[model samples]
Target: MNSIIYGPVPSWRLGRSLGVDLLCAPGKTCSFDCVYCQLGRTTSATTERREFVSMARLTEELKEVRGINADYVTFSGTGEPTIASNLGQAIDLARSILHLPIAVLTNSSLISREDVRGDLAKADVVVAKLDAHSQELLRQVNRPMAGLMLSDIIAGIKLFKSKFTGKLCLQIMFIEANKNFAVEIAQVASCLLPDELQLNTPLRPCPVKPLPPPQMASIKGNFHNFRNVVTVYEAPRPEVKPLNLQETLRRRPKL
Candidate 1:
């Protein structure tokens, strides 16, 4: 599937990102089947943690990286990067091999596990999802795997943020379903105290549409309590191209 290493794509958050896929199996594998997922539905949704890809192979492929063309080495392709049993080791390998800042984009479903948070702690920037505060709406929007609770996820995120020394950005995606709870989500954000609050809406191939500019703008206002905030509607995307068609389709689109 050419899933080992792909893209030096223009990312809304990380700039030119070279994606490293962890769950590069035959098809999509993840813990959440979010309605607005660009990579489509999860073919194998699970709560287990195991090495889905070889750590040695990732190290070898990273050694073969050709140029100093990427801004960040991102663990983002395929599925939730934290689910990889070798994530902590993978981050270590990538760091020793490539002289680039590491970024991990996680769905935060696995954050309840202390090990998962520890693995993610290696990254320079961790973009964690907080789509909904209420469990019912979380279930509807994210459609997390069985045993994943909204309360646990929030608690884990809070714990991680408290210990994490790197940049922590809480990504809050707005849609029709969760737009009404902007204030509630902001309250949760107040507790986490992330370095930045990324206000986002879908901008990829998905059934759910991005909320209108004004609607999303209205939602952004509620998050003024945060020190810094950015939104997808007005944030300028880099003119450079992103991932190729295949890699673009394999990972979650621009957040």
Candidate 2:
């Protein structure tokens, strides 16, 4: 079978994460043309969702993952996870067969929609992106789909905060363009009162050059009031044997 699932990739925050691609055919689809995207831009930007792959097929692949030891079962690959309308059903099915906690990485643009928020609520952890506090900066950094308003996105995040009881981690992808507005971004993050604020900069080659790592002393002095803040830079990879399907499954906990 052509693999619908890929990578027990090393994630700085989630440890060894097993990724589930809900959009794209192994590679395709996305909501934003992110400057720092590792997989490049979406050939077709869309909000529509379908069963990108059969649940039966995904379940079969997941059975292999069931033997791998991963810290998280992440809903992230080539694009935004929320764009998949069948996401809630997929999450339900995955939960039924997998014992690990689920994490969804979203751009936070669609979470304002009631249906999207309802679906995301099922995730154990929702890491939402908020790179810019102002509309202009939002446009520069994310280069989101046309008609996506920054104000509306913020409002959606606030709405999700009100209804979802799961852990919400605000991921701020700092770049040179938005570094000057760090204080303002921190203020905006304060309002959301996220469970955690993760400060990160582009580690991958970006369309635009990224800023130098934020001055830790300065950033700390400025944004310490907001909930727990954690800053990370890319860590050097350790050489290890590449894991095969059986080895990966052996490490994973039974559902």
Candidate 3:
């Protein structure tokens, strides 16, 4: 079987996370062609749920890497994890097959649907995204598929947080384009009542530059009222062993 369980990569939030690619398609596949995405653009961006990667194959591949030491088994790869039809099954099966806790990183485009929220709830931790507060800004930055409303995504995040028992972290990736509205975005996140708030910036091989640490710190001031808020730019990172050269390049290569 192909190495479906890749990485024990260094993550700012989750120590050494082993990645499980549920939608390891040929290229970048996502609901949004984010301007700051590490993988450039989404070639197969769609909201339709399908068997992008089979559960049986995931199980077989995971079994091959059972001996690898990891802190978390993350459902994240080339695109949105929620787009997979069997994401819930994958998480449940992974728990039985692996000792590590499961985490799902989603863009939050599909969270408006009950099925998407329910599927994400199975994970121990969920990192949901919210980059813009206005529709125009959302389109400029996230460039989501047609018919995806910013209001609906925000409402969905709040709804999911209300029902989910696991840890919920709201990721707000800051860029120069959305810098002015950082405070507004923070206010929206406060309403969601996420267990944790991650104020982040583009820190990958994307075309845009990351927000300056001092500037990010200034924005962090607005979120002071929200307990457990973390400035991702200031998070500590320990040495980590990546899955391999190829995997690192494919997922998130350091520039």
| Candidate closest to the true structure, highest TM-score | 3
Estimate TM-scores for all models.
0.94, 0.88, 0.96
lDDT of 2 by residue, 1-255 (tens): 346565676666777777787764644477777777766666768766556777787788888767676777888766778888878877887777778888888988888788899889999999999999888888888888888888998999998998888899999877667777889998898888899887777665546665565554455556789757777654333332334555434222111
Against the true structure, candidate 3 has what lDDT?
0.85
| Candidate lDDT (C-alpha), each | 0.85, 0.74, 0.85
lDDT tens digits, residue span 123-237, model 3: 9999999999899999999999999999999989989999999999998888999999977887888899989988888777688999989999998888888989888777887
Give candidate 1 misplaced runs (Cα > 4 Å).
Answer: 241-255
Which lDDT tens digits does candidate 1 get at residues 206-245?
8898899999889988987788999987776665564465
Better of 1 and 2 by lDDT: 1
List the candidate 3 regions with Cα displacement exceeding 4 Å.
253-255
**Considering TM-score, which of the candidate structures 1 and 3 is the better prediction for this target?**
3
Clashes of 2: 10
